[model samples]
Target: MAPENTPVHIIQLIKEITGFIQKGSPITYLGCPLYIGRQRIIYYSDLVAKVMKKISGWQSKILSVGGRATLIKHVLQSISIHNMAAISPPKTTIQYMKRVIADFLWGWDKEKKKISLGILGNS
Candidate 1:
């Protein structure tokens, strides 16, 4: 990789320390992509793509509402929670995920009518 704009002192210090290569922008620290700017759209683009992929999958649409809810819970929560613990995701990203999950739980076209909680056997 070409030389980055990292400080000369830090670079020299890193050079002094063994096995410390400089890492540049747009790095993934712990499975979550870290960007320099605070643009939620770009930062969450890969995540959104993954969600859209899951939504477009045949298995995603075929599951019943309960099953879809279960699967979606797994999809939205797992990695996000871990990433959130490390890096605070923007509020918009959280809202966007909620929207994605809602759209997935129902049909994207949203043709399904509302039903009571009791009918779904939830208390």
Candidate 2:
């Protein structure tokens, strides 16, 4: 009900109509964040971070290219499928996911500015 910069909105319940309770924006439905209307990408950062942690664990392991691709295509994609179904993901969120997947697929080296997309000796 308020702009992005604005703070909390208060709701006063009617003493006469003592049946329902009032809730606010940005509640979680199932595992996804639920809000009345459009929300910024930052809200979903924690969800993305959860996914990143999953990928990070796998990053250290030695898996074949096909295996990695499968995880990306199936597991990674499915993680946010429910959230995406509920609402469109912000551009930044999508980009962040892509970057994470790409980095996981091709080992990210601290020295290199960009990942090599190294699929040469995948097996």
Candidate 3:
């Protein structure tokens, strides 16, 4: 595929030489979307879903809070780092991930214990 403003003759020549069909942008490359235009949260939805899936999978396991924290640091973080390093994810996505982690650590029932994440982090 040719860049914007590329002459039609040149594009035709390249297509003829290589017999390649032209395609559009927004294709997934190395598990990341490569496209021109403004970035949107939708692009990173997969990353969010991945984090949720990982956390949900562990819900069945009986683990201590420390174990949950370890999984968050090692497993969840690793899953997101690749996409995060490539592009900045929306704050909403980050917040959702944090909330999910906190819920997993403290138990889903609000009445169980409602502690600020900052406070939880210190302890």
TM-score of 3: 0.67
TM-score of each: 0.62, 0.64, 0.67
lDDT of 1 by residue, 1-123 (tens): 436887788777877786767576666666688876665556766666776777777465568988887776676566467777877767777778767666667666756664433322222
Tens digit per residue, CA lDDT, model 3, 1-123: 678899999999999999987876666567677778887777777777887888778862589877877787788778877777887777776777778777877778876665665622432
Q: What C-alpha lDDT values do all the predictions have?
A: 0.67, 0.70, 0.75
Model 1 bad stretches (over 4 Å) = 4-24, 37-40, 58-61, 110-123
| Predicted structure 1, TM vs. truth | 0.62
Ranking by lDDT: 3, 2, 1
lDDT of 3 at 44: 73
By summed lDDT, which 10 consecutive residues of candidate 2 come out lowest?
7-16
Q: Which model, 2 or 3, shows the larger lDDT?
A: 3
Look at candidate 2 and tell me the lDDT of residue 31. 62
Candidate 2 structure quality by residue, lDDT tens digits, 1-123:
334664333223342356545456666676687765678787787679878888977854689867887887788778888888887878788878777777777667657776445432221
Separate clash counts for every candidate: 0, 0, 0
- Order the candidate numbers by TM-score, best to worst: 3, 2, 1
